[model samples]
Target: MTENQILQVLDKYAKDYNFPVLDNYNFDLAQCRLSVFRDDNEWIIVFEIVGVNPSLYISNDIYAYGNSVESQGLIIGLDDIVSLPNEEDLFDDEGNFLITPFHLDLIINSEPLIIKPTEGEYLELGIQTELFNPTKLIRYLSSKYKEKFWLEPLDLLNEINMSEDFKLFYQTDEWEHTDEEKPSENKFFQSLAKAIVLNDKNLIQFKKANTHWSNWTWSDFEKQEED
Candidate 1:
């Protein structure tokens, strides 16, 4: 079928299903392609945009361009898709590789939501580490990471970035505390910075120390006498 014909079908579904229009949703029919299907009750639309967001939207026609290519019955049975090139196969022209640092996951009321943070987020994190002020850092981070009743975990980080209050807080300096009082503050901040950059376990250790969420402490590491 022609692109126009496929679009007409999608338009019908958009009206019937009330699929939301994505922000700045525009695509070129010649360059990009899509696949559409319904899994259970939800509509899934997958995009194949080169060097851009490869997304699967739920009940959204924003990327639903056409009917997916029909699968032919396999001539030879294969247990895995290892024949196809994966994202790991991609590399730069200069041969230096790019890697995804971390993916955020959350279980909200028993449903799992996962998302990868944008490159801009990593840049912002680097700036935050550079401008680190130990005394106000916790309060600053708390204001950003505070619980939101309405937000899905995927939306929370974006919401934090959008907040005008956070922008002001990020820009201002209010460090009045002495280094003597919190001697370990710099080291703690360093660990936190390293954790953010490397997406390591150091962040958890730092949070446990600072927040006192559990009763765990240095004393917990005390070696018990061998029986």
Candidate 2:
């Protein structure tokens, strides 16, 4: 149907659904579909709208949009989406990357640094590592690994221009204050960075110590591990 026709149908449901709109005549739709069905032998018209948010009534729209909609079938699939080559500079004239580094954080939280009691080491600043502190989480997660750094993990954080917060997690047993062999500083950051950027992991691909692939997430070794 034409955009006007679809707009009319959404308008018809507008009052009943109270979809977030600037006015009575307007609604946002990036994409939409109209479905017709027989329910209890009566025809029902369904409007599926992929709405874009450009307003303050987002919370109302989020739950309200789906409230009046019902399902016939649901399908979700994933495929590699090809990104077109762009000659556009990724950085500004100031030499800073145009893209921003997004940090994932949560409400203040802490998790214990798993240490063997035999070592008798403790932090006076609370025995548990602050999981919310990126550096401590990095170190704590690193302590769980047994691999040695192929690329000095601490150095990797600096070389890649990671923030100062990440620079403190040393990839060594001494940092952990335990005799147990240190986990790979290299793999620890690699794994952590990989996890942090799982959606855009390729955005900062680096050839680290143990891995040969630049993608890091998928390789013969990684695939084998997953299998």
Candidate 1 stretches with Cα past 4 Å from truth are 17-20, 23-45, 48-227
Cα lDDT, all candidates: 0.26, 0.25
Alpha-carbon deviation at 166 in model 1, angstroms: 48
Residue 207's lDDT within candidate 2 is 41
For candidate 2, write residues 67-132 as lDDT tens digits. Answer: 123421121111111111243333356754332212212111122222232112215212233222
Q: What's the number of clashes in each of the models?
A: 0, 2
Candidate 1 lDDT, 117-170, residue by residue in tens = 554554553323332221112222223342211222223223222222211101
What are the runs in model 2 whose C-alpha is more than 4 Å off?
1-13, 16-27, 54-227
Clashing pairs for predicted structure model 1, backbone only:
none
